[model samples]
Target chain A: MSSTTQIPFVDYLILDDPPYLQAQECKSCGARYFDRRNACANCFANNFQPVAVQSEGVVTSFSIIQMGPNPYVSAIVDCGGTNVKCTIMKVEPTPDHVTLGMRVKLMTYSMGEDNEGTEAVAFGFEPI
Target chain B: MGTDAIWIIGSNMTKFGKHPDKDVVDLAAEASRDALQDADISLSEVGVLGVGNLMNASAGIGQQLQKQIGQTGIPVFNVSNACATGATALRVAIMAVKAGETDVGMAVGVEKLAGAGLLGQRGPKPEAETWQPNGRFGALSSTEGRIGTSIMPGVFAQVGMEYGHKYGGASFELFAKISEKNHAHSTLNPLAAYQKRFTLEEIMNDVMIAYPNTRPMCSGNCDGAAAMIVVSDEKMKSMPSEVQSRAVKVSASVLTSDPYEDGCQILPDVNTLTKNAASQAYEQAGVGPEDLDLVELHDCFATAELVHYDNLMLCEEGGAVDFFQSGAPWRDGTKPVNVSGGLQSKGHPIAATGIANIHEIVMHLRGEAGDRQIEGARVGLAHVIGLGSACGIHILEKVA
Candidate 1:
């Protein structure tokens, strides 16, 4: 029931230079959807174009995780399109201070470093 | 309206978790036989069969169980509802007797986690490639960032952190205390997963799983089964006095599903469902929480039990820590809880947890809960909550 905005493949690749966050958008309903799909999640409109969105939103809800496979800041972001919930990277002092409606900007980082030291970059949010 | 009253005649359960020698069918049949033998009844006397199994992993559980139990003609219905499968089955059996559908019905909840081995034993998986904005696939699976982790501990840890932040204190001490208490109680329960006692300091300093949550605070995965037999008063009258003496009446059995609201915490939803269920149960049993002698709540994590205290109205919100510190909810407490160690110590085999809770309450009411029995328990309550926020609450009273 909530609206979502998608980040186009071209925009994501140009921004962080990765294909993981590529998304598609519908011009009719203005709903953005993540993951590569030919059809839009809303309005079922096939008419769409590539666009770069500022990877920033406010933290709506967050949890200070303790016992997980890999500890990270998990939260929901109201990115003016669809309030997306995503894990943030390189944030410190726990997710408690990342209060509701607090500004957060996305960053490219890896959860854990690889052997080659050229970390696998993924999209994460941080306090603005 | 039914003329006869439904009474629980007997209950039995096997130790939970990873028994290679026993498969799911074996566990169900074994527990069924044990329950029947405990009641001194034969398989032919079972007019109907109800089975609760969440994940039997490609095995045709219902058909297989009927074959294993040697019950050929009677109706055997298989029920599944994430973690509340066992409780759901029990409800069906109770209703059948209450509605005059059958004179005798058996409810059995079984799981064979051991057969799955390690890789197959992982927690619930994601639906597909649809990635959630939270970097996770769905509600069940972990984020791509964190694989091989469980959602139970992770979700509860989030609750713990929120509670800590709002209350201006850390939850480590409370979590440790809860673990310590359940562990102490488990020492007296022979069937519990972990019988070793743990100190608060030990629980606090143990290996961390998520923040503020230690390994001991989380429940371990295991395999096992539990079963109970219910019969109408007319059928029960023909049984031996010893069997009749153990009869426990079903006061209430209620189930509820998830609410439509998003961002709603899991524990609060459980509280709402519990209150609704308990109110109905108390009215039917002619008693209230104040009159309860003992209870067995779903304690998959230490924090879960603590949250239950407030949710079950044992204490006020933010009052569980104080109530727990006062040594209440213990075997000697006014209203003892988790005397069988709960899921924290007893092991969580998903579907089996509900019937398992009922099994403990029946034992307590029968004055057969060796060592951990609440002295002269007249009324007891059991609450089992599952994934997707499904919950079942059963209230039992000893038949005079």
Candidate 2:
């Protein structure tokens, strides 16, 4: 044991910005899709372009989870360009107020600071 | 869909729940022997073996079970699909028999929950990242981390809440009613883990596990096994004509997975897979959902059972609450659901659930379901949902 105290640190760097969720736009059908695939699901088109979407969308459906190990606000977001299912974050009031079809914006923040004081960020949506 | 090819001649299940005295091998042997006896067939006649299991991958489960039963040289395979493992194994066995790969095949789903003392008690411990709670924002650190805290109760809780929100009812009340119904039915099932009936008052007042869900409303972890024998028509013909006549035909078997699309709530999420699979099963059986006299759904939670009522097309979306409130899913209801007590009361020995569901449906169709038996039952359906929102649905028809 040494007299000098050594601080522990996270081994790897984690991102603090909202990582972009990747999707595809079919060249033939102009249909946008999440969950990456080589061929387009809508028209079976092989030609596609990768698109990065912002976390702005409306809640299509949501559930107020009361049970389980880890309970959170679960919802499905119908982003105008593509629909994405995700969890909402940092709501001050009751989960019931998070209505279906409510407009929301994405938030990016450091989840926690590393041993080196580096921040690890993640993406979540909040009511606008 | 091969006609006059394959049939499920025999099925059986061991009692489910904690059994420290018995291990996986014991459970499997008991179920296997019961199934063989039910079919009146010898172990030597089985040309293929399939085992369904999860969380216990300590080597070859199929081989271990085969050795326990004193049978060897037959091809053995293991299958895992979360909660649908049993159904998946049965499908493989049925397909093999239909394809003429084997004359007689057996599917066994055995698990020892006692060995899995806690969620992560058995096998290699999952990385710490996988243990993170949902809503923990950041770059997921491990493969398990991506899965989040999507356990059975949590997943079904969302469904219960969704039903409450959409139907303008109290989620707790609906949950209590569903629990009461299942408990009442379980009283008639001697093999059920929870045979005592729970009043709505008791269910409502129980300790809360998740919002709107209580201890009585959720399924308990249990240990046991179930087995079924599938034989070709030619093989069945060699047996007595009376035995062949009593055999149930495999009308349809279908499986589907989640699309994981946006605007898809985890709860009440339209499993396009379940819908498509149900459609295919219905088409193969040459019948529709309306023709079914009874159904066995994956009711790991009361909420799950309610959502399945809608998902399986027993009723329209958001109509399950009303159906439950009206006692329409009870034993005497128009479409009796979970007459076998369901996972909530019957016990969810994960690997055993699928085959156990089939066991109960077969009993109902054969007019042997004792006190919970439905009268004039001609058609029955069983649906099971697994991890990643995967689903498997099978439709069984009684032979005229």
Candidate 3:
């Protein structure tokens, strides 16, 4: 048996212990963003602090994408005040199964493994 | 600004469809030549040249155009601004003349996108369905599949759905109906990519692209080119009576980008910037939406057109659905829209779309449009929006 080491797919995603997303919150406007930035897009302040994003969120908008390799649900989730774009995993990709204002929580799953037995983990939101 | 107005003396475009025999520069040169002939102007008289191209930006299309059309030693500016590249190119020429850099300037926009599939369709995996990671952790996987979508159809699909959720309307059939109208309009436009009309049933039952948007509802990806020649008021006075008689006045030319907005960065906001541009254009032209006789908007998707009706202020606030349901955008309706079949059938050649839209408007305003002409069309508006968040609007008036 081979032991696999897990790694976060993006810099904003944390893999240690409980996986959660981290955002660069503006010190001036209190705006949160997942990507790294030199200044806040809202107030244009150069200072930003990395803050942990809430795992639970409500679906604000979604689309059932069929153009992909397989049918999947692409959605924007409103976590408290911040909005996150993610796929709704572990649910049927249907209008009845997925809907607006649906409650979901962030979860990590293995995408695939490499020659070194290192697993790349990606995050998605699942029904809570 | 005193009668120091700018006028589009000549405008022309190649039939928007497959041009297997011609290349990009060939199409650009043809359109430029035709436009110059229409203007009764010679290449030696053109003071500046602005070329718009997206897929072939690094090629220095402006310099290449000069080689084919005549080398007048004029300032050449090659611009690329997503779908708005063409409009941006024309803007460059207008600005040159406005700044007293040149009196007569030429702007050309060309693109060869025939057989180009969906805008953001992803390619094959790294290793034939098998992953062989080599990085410190592993091969970096994209956020597209795991997170929300990045494709144009999906983005617009969500945007349309959001509009429905907010205001309560905009059904799937409604969006399909919008596509049907555009397809029907294409039947009269010989230059359109697909001239055959599709019924509402056919459109609704067509292959699904995202959700509400079917295959027929999307813009046609085809090859085409359009060119325009602009002259200042001072130069227009010196032109012949016949040459000045057909010139169309450029009342307003406005371009805008995305402003900082919350929860909209991931999915580009197509409405805000468009609304901003439309208002600015109307203000600059000293007119309102009621004054528009016809409009050629960026209908990259049927769903997009609905939101833009409101964004363009063609209708009342939160009344896009009502505007369509009222049949005001039809060819014979009160406010004719996309009389040239829009991008849906006119074909979206990217860089060419901007100038092509203006070309359609100019043709109608001059009462030169053949079968697809809007009768008594005097004031027209041309709009094109690019995904990287750029919106360009030009309001044209027939010089009396």
Candidate 4:
């Protein structure tokens, strides 16, 4: 395993001065995605350009999953460009606590540490 | 879609739910055997066998299941499209018969959803990834995937919430009502997993799974198998009068994939896919939703059933609540959605679900739905959705 203490969980995630998410934009259309696609879902474009997306967005939808490997607040956050599925880091998974149309920003933190103490980091959005 | 007569001569299904005594192969072979028996045909008569399955953790299931019934070297094709696997398999069978590729074909679907085994595994090797959000869709190395712990339930609960957000007066109560009705509908289905009814209060009070979704509101993870025998119309003419009178026509079988676009939305996401498939199916059948007498839709969640009400054109936009309250989706309701208790009550065995939906409709088309039977039901539609994703819509009409 790499000994990097600050590792972005997914390849598209870039840990910069102020962390942000990167997505692939279809050359044929303005549509963007978190990962590389062989072909665009829109216009069937094969060429794409990587662009930085502001983690800041509004919650379009949310669901509190109670039965799973972990019980958490799952939200579909629309960042003006695309929708991302992730958990709300700082909120409970309840309708009363998490409201629709709430503003949120992308946040990243160490998820867990390995035996070597190297931390595995993850990204999520939190209510602004 | 062809002039050639294709009819559903046989249908068979195992009582859905957790089956401790049955393995995946056992379930497949048993259902296939019963289907062949029901059709009054020998295994040698079936030229091709199409199998639908989701997880292949227990690899080579098609061949493995064939071994249980003594494989005769007839080719077995396996199609996996998450939950739509079964429907896709049946579609392939229908297409083959329509093309005269085979006079008789067998379509079978089987799955072991929960228990000591993982979703697809037949052993006790705790494959915890099955319980993870997005299954294989989520990138484990991605920070986005790690934070998204909510999978299907959370995704659908958002659908319910979004429907309420868009159309006032829709909430958990409406979702629970759908669940309550399906559970009640299951009470009349002998093959339904949960053949019992729950009140709205009881449904709402059930264990909270996703915020708006409870255990009862969501489909149960269980093991089961279902099968259908699709025969060419030419072959149909040779069958006995009794069998000929019970034939059901396959008017349309349409399937589609997700059309991803900018501004990705959730509750609205499925509606787009469903609408496309439903329209294509209606066109292929040369009929509109207005002609549909009963529907066996993918009720993977309560919201799906509710949202699909509008998507399939069963009701006007934001008209689900009023349409539902008017008894449109009840057992005796004009629409009669999920007369087999739907996946919410029948237990979703992934691949088996589509075939199960087909079995339910065939029963209704043949006037054999018994207690849940709709008088003079003629046209019916069966639907299934898989998350990678694929949507399948098939229209079945009774033919004498």
- Number of the top TM-score candidate: 3
Local accuracy of candidate 4 as per-residue lDDT tens digits, B306-338: 888887889998888888989989977878899
lDDT value for candidate 1?
A: 0.70
Candidate 3 displacement at residue A45 in angstroms: 1.5
Docking class for candidate 3: medium
TM-score (chain A) of candidate 3? 0.93
lDDT of 1 by residue, B2-105 (tens): 54568888799998867888778888888989999988888888877888897763455767988877856888778887678899988888878788778898
Q: Which lDDT tens digits does candidate 1 get at residues A18-110?
A: 333433456765555543446653456777755555567765435545544556655655565544546665566353554555788766543
Q: How would you encode candidate 2's per-residue C-alpha lDDT over B26-140 as one tens digit per residue?
A: 8989999999999889889888888888857556788888887866698888988878888888887887887788899999988776534224212334434322322222233
Reference-based lDDT, residue B187, model 2: 91
Candidate 2 docking category? incorrect
Per-residue CA lDDT of model 2 for A67-111, tens digit only, reads 435456656566765655556776632345766567887665445
Q: Best candidate, DockQ-wise?
A: 3
Q: Enumerate clash totals for all models, in the order shown.
A: 15, 8, 0, 7
For every candidate, the chain B TM-score is 0.88, 0.90, 0.96, 0.90
TM-score (chain A only) of candidate 4: 0.87
Q: What's the ranking of the predictions by lDDT, best on top?
A: 3, 4, 2, 1
lDDT of 1 at A4: 33
Candidate 3: which stretches are off by over 4 Å?
A2-4, B1-3, B122-139
